[model samples]
Target: MTLRTATAGDLTAIMDLERTSFPTDAWSEPMMQSELASPHGRYLVDVEAGRVIGYGGVRAVQGSADADIQTIALAEAARGRGRGRTLLRALLEVARERGAREMFLEVRADNPVATALYASEGFVEIGRRPRYYQPDDVDAVIMTLDLVAWAAHRAADGTALDAGACS
Candidate 1:
């Protein structure tokens, strides 16, 4: 029932969530460990009753602030009750705080739920790449969101948009 900044110690649980939530595209343990340890990325995790339930992270790059919505997954038993939205906003907030004005990500075009969530957050469909996701050969549709307003709104409203309405 709480959200906190992610730390290296959270990797084991984070990896578990990744494995279950994104079976085909989960980050390797080393990669999650590295990103959690990174000085360049901002990671936020949701924990409930001492277990990691959800997490999201982003890294700023170049001058454009290209960001990767590294991972977002709620523990299977923890799904529903709006945990995902809260985790997502927490990550976006951190990204903006770290000088990210714009963010980019690729999602499976067929994931209408995720697509709608991003769209609600002001992420617009920009372009697409054929077979961006390997093995399954599923295409990834690129989406971009302007964090300037997202930041301003949160600052101005201060959680006016709660965990249930991130998208």
Candidate 2:
């Protein structure tokens, strides 16, 4: 798989996977379009044999105290191969580069897979939003991470916290 910064052209494929991944809570086309064009957001796509199989994004304003993980999704076939972690780590790196001291995200309370991924990356549940996911009545699990601490931990473990790690 090849990982790269996402471009506007990747929106169609991103939306395809978005709908598949979040059947009940997919963002509208206009929202996604605006996200891709936003100066504060950084989005990425994972390609395999010329297909966009996964994507993730984060919103971080320069010098912001905190950044938000807007979204992260993988194709059904791409699950359980550590690609989700890779995409997440990439987004965290983006947040750090933008001078964010902390990061936050909301995951579906029913999705243990995603929650575990975030936990493994040093995120901790800080709160929850009741019925944050509409129609399904699923709660949203809010999680946060201290970027400085996370980076220090990764560095102490001899891991490169660089964007090049996305490969």
Candidate 3:
């Protein structure tokens, strides 16, 4: 699989992946189109067999050097192959290079896979927003990671954190 920065051309496949990975909370086509055009945002995709198998979105606030992960998902057929973690690490690397010092995201409290992935990536549970996932009314758990530390760990380990070790 190959991961690359997304462009408008990748919108259709991205939406396709979103629909399958997040049936109840998929991002609309326009929502994705806008992100691809945003100056402060980035969208990335992992391609396999010429298809977008997984993707991630993030926004980096210019002045503050803060970044927030908007969403990350993998196609149903792409799960369990560590693609999700790879996409996340790539996004985080983009965040760090863009001068972001911190990163944050919200996940469903019951999404063990996501929560675990975030945790293993050096994210710490900071707090939660009760019933934040309105689509399903599931609580949202907030997690934060210190990019400096994360990078140091990755460097010390001689590579990016392995998704296999997630949670």
Candidate 4:
């Protein structure tokens, strides 16, 4: 598998995954196109055999003190293999590179797997937005991570957080 920055050419594949991953709340193609064209966003696609298997993005204006994880999704076959974690770390790194001191995201309250993934990445539950997910009426669990502390912990453990690592 390979991960790289996303481009307009990958929009079709991305939309496919987005619709499949979030069947009820998928962003429209126009919205996704706008996101890809946004100056404050950095999006990435994970590919295998020239096919996109996962994608994610972060919104971080240059010199900003904080960033938001816009979205992250992987094909069902790509889950539970650390691919989501890899995509997440890459998005976080992009945010950090853009001078963000902290990162924030919202996950569905009913999705334990996603919630656990964020928690394992040093993100703490800061608050909640009741009934934030429409149609399903699921709450949104807001989480935040301190980039400086996260980097320090990684350094202390001697584990390099290389976003480009293929394995």
**Per-model CA lDDT versus the true structure:** 0.76, 0.91, 0.84, 0.91
Model 2's TM-score against the true structure: 0.96
Give the clash total for candidate 3: 0
Instruction: Identify the runs in model 2 with alpha carbons over 4 angstroms from their true place.
Output: 164-167
Per-residue CA lDDT of model 3 for 1-167, tens digit only, reads: 78777889988888887788777887788988999899897788888888778889888766556799999989777888888888899888778877898999999998999999999999999998998875888889999999888988899989874332321
- lDDT per residue, candidate 1, 68-135, as tens digits? 67767777787667777777776776666566788888889878878888887778999999998877
| Model 3 lDDT on a 0 to 1 scale | 0.84
Which lDDT tens digits does candidate 2 get at residues 1-167?
77898889999999999999999889998999999999998889999999999999999998999999999999999999988888888888888988999999999999998999999998999999999899999999999999999988888988745774554
Model 1 CA deviation exceeding 4 Å by range? 61-66, 155-167
In terms of TM-score, the best-performing candidate is: 2
TM-score-superior candidate, 2 or 4:
2
After TM-score superposition, the amount by which residue 38's alpha carbon in candidate 2 deviates from its true location, in angstroms, is: 0.3
* C-alpha TM-score for every candidate: 0.85, 0.96, 0.91, 0.95
With a 3 Å backbone cut-off (N, CA, C), the pairs that clash in candidate 2 are none
Q: Give me the runs in candidate 4 sitting further than 4 Å from their true place.
A: 162-167
